[model samples]
Target: MPVAFRLPLQVFYEREARHPRQPFLVQPIGGGAVQTLTWGDVGHQARCAAHWLRARELPQGSHIALISKNCAHWIIADLAIWMAGHVSVPLYPNLTADSVTHVLQHSEAVLVFIGKLDDWPTMAPGVPAGVPTISLPLCPAGDFDYRWADLQGCSPIQDDPLPPASALATIIYTSGTTGLPKGVMHSFGALGFAATHGTELFGLGEGDRLLSYLPLCHVAERMFVEMASIYTGQTVYFAESLDTFLTDLRRARPTALFGVPRIWTKFQMGVYARIPGKRLDRLLRLPFIGKRVGHKVLAGLGLDALRIALSGAAPVPEALLRWYQRLGLDVLEVYGMTENCGYSHVCRPGQQKIGWIGLPCPGVEVRIDQAGEVQVRSGATMLGYFKDAQRTAEVLTEDGFLRTGDKGEQDADGRLRLTGRLKEIFKTSKGKYVAPAPIENRLAEHARIEQVCVVGDGLTAPMGLCVLSTVGQPEARHALQDSLERWLEQVNAALDKHERLRQLVVVKDTWAVENGFLTPTLKIKRNVIESTYGPQFQVWSERTEVILWQD
Candidate 1:
């Protein structure tokens, strides 16, 4: 790792008060131009918003909600919420009205700031009646009690609350893949410590850059993009839309990049589209010219400047890791949950290990319980699930270890390999237990499969129900069947008796957040998958073909 980039929580105050004109946030504007907001600009706008809050005379720790996509105003509102001595509750912009109402009611929020949204009609009804609302400039629908622009003409706050380390910073709700999402509370100390620890691990600073695109409501993106920029003074770029993602990446050319497994897989697919895997494989194996070949490929993907590329939030395929390594990109896999501020473990660069999440972070303690569940304790561990005392008690042990629902094995070398979620391990009709994660990891490398869920709940053996990649259609299935069959055979040979997949059924429909198959953070909803495809499992498993077409 490079020299540790240290910037305390005072970094934000100092940047605004001392170096006011310093570049901070870069916002994408229409007509292809960009807008740069300086620290001074942010401080002023935040002060204005703080004044608005002060005028309202809300309770000292009253909950305020922020619903928006990633944008400059979103961060400003967060800062102002804290400055005004209120706790912020952020909701995913795409959340349904019922979920929105659940959070607003659960958190007891009195005021909300609405911002960029793909669908406002569904999100609007979620706000509880009598709650006041302010609109961020990014909001498309433009319906709100007050516009963020209204704050522009207001005077700056003469005095603001100076919160101590113990003050609550935010309550980030978990992207509910199973049950109702729980709000994970974080103190200012925990958030600051997480950001400082991140800088130590990644060496991010003023010279570095970040692209803000993922939902800001999620802790991973919030930590990496928003908090990191505050603590390290990194310039943050906002992606205009999904269409300009590659363009944004190319323009930012960030030195540090973090993506979930799906993003990395998408990048891999993009590369394969331009250069056939066999041809690219040959180019990398050449003598003396291999390095040049890699440089060109990475530059094409706008990853040439990346010194640190991380993949997490799910299991990454071994084949995908090897594929990137061949192209001179080492994508380290980090593992953590929202309850811990995502600071549990990360694979160190140059000490590469495939199929295992690396050593514990600087101050984090990790252990495997008798149930084989991964438990963690750290300064960054959340205070508790908001307004859910019983649920909090269920997860936290007497001594304070957070019982991560994930089941894993920690090696003597301190690397942890996740097996599956404790509740996700299903027993077959034969009374044999099967862990689907490992098998799914193997199948995820299939070029035609975007996501795969292995199910065997009441069957003799497990079968895969996969949502095809863009090219994973019925026509391509028959052609790719032989190759996939050979690969599945190899994977099955390596697995235990009950873990083997009998067949893979390809589905025609897509799985997305809009379709209710995915969480806001893009993690697949296993329960939804089971409900949608469980009925077809019998027919799929009964088929003689190793890879069967369902659509």
Candidate 2:
């Protein structure tokens, strides 16, 4: 279908008005206290906020950055900006002060809406000189410069029309898993098309409810919440906090859900913890017991009622997907980058191939370039990187396809399987090339392992450095270690002799963004991991068995 000419959110409000009393968002503030908003409330809040934004009289294309977690106010603010004819720039809540400043300066944003303050005051200096920053209207502790309630109270702007679909909609910064994050500019038409196409694939329509916990600042959530909701008129419930996530899940009982691979891994772990993996696996192989256990597992996870549960942002362990399938939750693994307005290829419902990100959505054309890199061009592709024309030109081919930077292969069935990052492959000392991803993924398949980083850029053989050994299941640690070693042997056997893992380094505790071992996208920074644990690598390589890194 052609991208709709009208701003998608405007169409959304019309549907909300038609079903004003229907529950739109169910937010749990805490302590079993729930704040529910009907369709009318969402429409009213958005309208009031839009009126306040218009009163500011900013330039037609003024950029406004919203720094916040997922919340009702975030959506209200985003829709208001578009309704009032401006660009919405979303900043990840946990961004460093340096990154915050870089993004604000790069986008030339005039105003900022900060929701919750974790690193804000320190990050404020990054806002650039002369940029007037306003608080995100959230009532958090510490002095706040502005309140969202005040914005709602501002004089109403006579209901003005929304901009056309061709107008600029948003600038989403890349998670910066590699180099400095670049802002990708997307038009309303492209975003709307992706959403509409996704809606068709999922068979979503009015009355569908979506639990919104993923960061609204990211392209995935923008597509799932802003665009998909607009196209399907689905009720979106904003999660209050991580503590209240499970309760919120039961309350909303969402028909559709989206989560990253990490979250899915956690869910898989939770199920195995409840029913021991061995028992569950044995039961799944049985006839009637298999079906009964699967149903029970699905209901326990509150996914029995779900139409679809999607995982994205990283490659999912095929084992985890199989486990969920055993429990009757058909979790679909999707693939797309920030350069594409999030739905490039999605696993077709009931036609899933575990570990493969299924076929491309309708109207999307994907092909492997000569270098084996996946490149795609579609109505959903971003126009270009914001203010980085030279870099944008490098990624976009003369024919208009966007270079995805990921190596892939398309099977006969059109299922796309990711190989590894083109940049992440390194040559070992023995002159054989190694890709750390498959090795790391294979190691992480062990439930005891939480994170893995395969290093040895110039070593005779690559080394697998992992940071996990059963986070609370100490009794299973020894068995877990043995299982992990066996798994590594199987993986190494598959690789060329020189590319095999010489030894495994099981580092205790977790390596996280806060700890500086991993990037914000949860990808391990190989250089950081190697530099911090260089000595451990030397010792582990000399040992025949898997050696645990002791502090």
Candidate 3:
């Protein structure tokens, strides 16, 4: 199957020409209002902004940084950058001033676009004094050299300039779970191949709707929402804030929804809050009313129309997957990374395995190397890490496979099941190697545990450091302790002697992006968690109790 690479801009131009009045972006404003932009409207704004960018006389292919939460103008700014023959450098909306400065300097970005953000004051200082800044719509109050409103009045660029397929399009920085974020460079061809083929694999097209809530900086959201929308001519809706996420979702009733494991868990918990899990289970057991009841439940949660429910970024628990299945929703697990344009593998609708990421995508080749690491080669593979040849050489093989650090195994059917990160596997004091991800996944099955990290580098056995979920927080301390102790015993019974957890420690502090315990994508920072709790591991292991609460 040969792929015809169509650059995103070219796709956009074609779509705009065919259906200029079709709604492309729906952005939520305050007071339950929304602003809808047609294909023509979006193209006009992007063209106008492109003219503004061209007026600056920056060097061709200059890096321009964009900082924003998901919004209409973020996409506009991205189009403007690309149309002006500049490369985009998108930073996560939630970043510290130091991190902002580091990425800006490292990427050598000459200009920056500031869009919708909650904490502009803290991050504003990171912009160097001389570098120019432009403010997108809904941006926080700031001193910017240019504003979206001002750019909108400029004459739109006359001609549609389609960048070459092989031209550098964007530099997406990793979430930096371990060290400084590395910039992953992607060509227009790479992004185009992924979006074109990926949407085809999922059978998405013009009529499909998507809600864009995830950070557009991440490759998953970029490929799924931004680039996929370009290829498929899908309508995208933006979420306003956390408080109104459900309301926004309900309004859009997206046909395709993508979420990380944490988001899926939160949705499940939200349903549980309205109707207790046991009560819902009993209702679902009724033959006559069960199907309707399930439909009603999903409709209330704004997922009734969802044709494709995708989960990725981290492993979702098998229990969670089964729970959704009972509700008539098949949450497809996708596997990929920043290096592969997030298009390596996906679980097809009817062929999904419980804990496995499905077969390699149409143009993707996957193999398990001698070290048990999953390596992938695809047309969607990135150009390389921006300005980091040494790091690029370290990951990309001589034969062009991107060496994914994840340890995985393939079944006879070629479905990939990831066990753990190669670097995250730790040796216990007894010289037994332990993979924390599987243990953490099992422990996370409990409704009480919102987050868990299994760590015991030099201890007798691994112990779980957990944070309580909303359901667990309201329970009485004694009852919660009893429940956790029972769960711990149940989990241990299924594990080998060396792999069994010694105890479960409930940490008072929640892991969050703000606190540096989690990456922006909500993956636990192992090094941070270990460093924060390493001093007490021995002390906790010495305790005889099956469950321990942090002071």
Candidate 4:
């Protein structure tokens, strides 16, 4: 099916004209209060901001950077950049000063927008000394050249400016789990195709509501919340902070929600903390009480009204999906990358396969090469990596397919099930190759385990290293050790001789973003983990105990 393509600004203009008074953005200020902006309000602010940008007379298609957590002003700033015929470059709000400096210098962004952030002091030094900056509402204390208030009195740009569909829209940097981040360039037409076809495929429209809590710099959130809202005319709500997430969720009562695997796991753990999982399971098996309990639990989480629940950014464990399924929520797994505008595959509502990432999306084509890497071609494919032609040509083929680097297989029905990353496969001392993701996923089925990494790579056999969840932290060491031993035995029973784990080691330190163990998107950095723990691997593997503790 050929879908109609329209630029994001064009769609926003139409929505603004059709329903000027409709609530378009719901932003949570401080102190348990929210300010709802109508389409008219957002249009006026965006137009005024656009006028401010145009007055500066920056070069055509100048790169303008935006650094902020998800907020109303973030979207307004993006609109202003597009209207002023400039390209946007969004930096993750959680990036370090070094990363911020690298992106700004590489993109050559002439101007920057500073918005809501938690750690401004650490990142403020990265903005080059002379670069101009505009501050958005809720921004941390800084000496910005312009503030949101400064744009209030400017006359709104009367004419609607429509850039060509092929114009560059944004440059989203990769999460850089392995090395330095690469800038992925996406055109307006590419993003428009994803937003348009995705909205139609998901049956989204004006009645839908979404909460924008994920980092807007991520393609998943940009396509799901920012671009989708413009295409579907849906209302977007911003989460205030981690402490008030539940409060913000309840206030929004969004009809659609998107969460990553870690968030879902945390939610499950939260539920277990209050109502023991065993007791909740028993209650959910009962006749009339099961329905009531399910409704109550979902309502408590402020997801009772969610018509669509999506999980992406990382592979979700099958056990986690099943747990949510028992609770009357079907978390559809989605698979895509920054190179494809996050619009490749999705598990359709009725046709969801537990472990599979589902079929290719409406206009996406998927294939598996001889090496088992998943390759995708779509209208939403990126133009290429910005200023790195050699690297771009290596990943994107002459035929337009993007090498996804994920090893996967397709069922007879065409659903894609990812096994592991091609680059992550390692050889043991015996020259036996092992893929850690499948083993880690199997070990993660145990409720006590929070994060698991299987390491062997030149060793005789692989071993599992894990960080305990909050639920597992308080349990007696002996009991927890016995439980892990039994779980390890069960998991090993299903593996091949060479693939069986030699032992399980419980690490003392937690894996987190701040400590350099995880990326901003919460994906584990394998190189960092290996470097930090590699010295202890031989000693731990030589131990006799089935479950060893880091001493």
Q: Which window of 10 residues has the lowest lDDT sum in candidate 3?
A: 1-10
Off by over 4 Å in 1: 1-9, 158-160
496-517 in candidate 3: lDDT tens per residue?
8999999999999989989999
Reference-based lDDT, each prediction: 0.85, 0.78, 0.92, 0.91
TM-score of 3: 0.98
- Candidate 3 residues lying further than 4 Å off, grouped into runs, are none
| Residue 482 C-alpha lDDT in model 1 | 82
lDDT string for model 4 (1-551, tens) is 66677778889999999999999999999998899999999999989988988889889899999999999999999998998889999999988999999999999999999999999999999999888889999999989999988876689999999988789999999989999999999999999989888888788889989999989999999999999999998899999999999888888888888888888888888888889889999998999999789878989988888889999988888999988887888999998999999999999998888889998888898889999999999889999999999999999999999999999999999999989998889999999999999999889888988888998998999999999989888889999988999999999999999999999999989999888998878888999999999999998888899999886
Please write out the lDDT profile of model 1 over residues 1-551, one tens digit for every residue.
Answer: 32233323356787788778888888887667788999999988999889888888878988999998888888989988988888889999888899899999998899999987788987788888899899988787756898888866679886645777688888999998898999999988788777778767877678888888888889898888888888878888888888888998898888888898889888877887777778888989998788899988899888999888888889999999998898889999988889988889999888778989899988888889998999999878889998889999999998999999999998889999999988889999999988888889998988777898888998989988787675455444457788778878988999988788888776767889899998877788999988988787777777788777665
What is the C-alpha lDDT profile of model 2 across 287-368, one tens digit per residue?
8889898888777766777888898888888888888888777889888888888868899889998768899988889989
Residue pairs clashing, model 2: 101-126, 114-136, 137-148
Model 4 spans > 4 angstroms off? 1-3
Error of 1 at 531 (Å): 1.0
The segments of candidate 2 whose C-alpha lies over 4 angstroms from its true place after superposition are 1-6, 117-130, 135-138, 469-473, 476-478, 519-521, 534-543
TM-score for each of the candidates: 0.96, 0.93, 0.98, 0.98
Superposition error at 217 for model 4 (Å): 0.5
lDDT of 4 at 270: 80
Clashing pairs counted in every model: 0, 3, 0, 0
**Which residue pairs in model 3 clash with each other?**
none
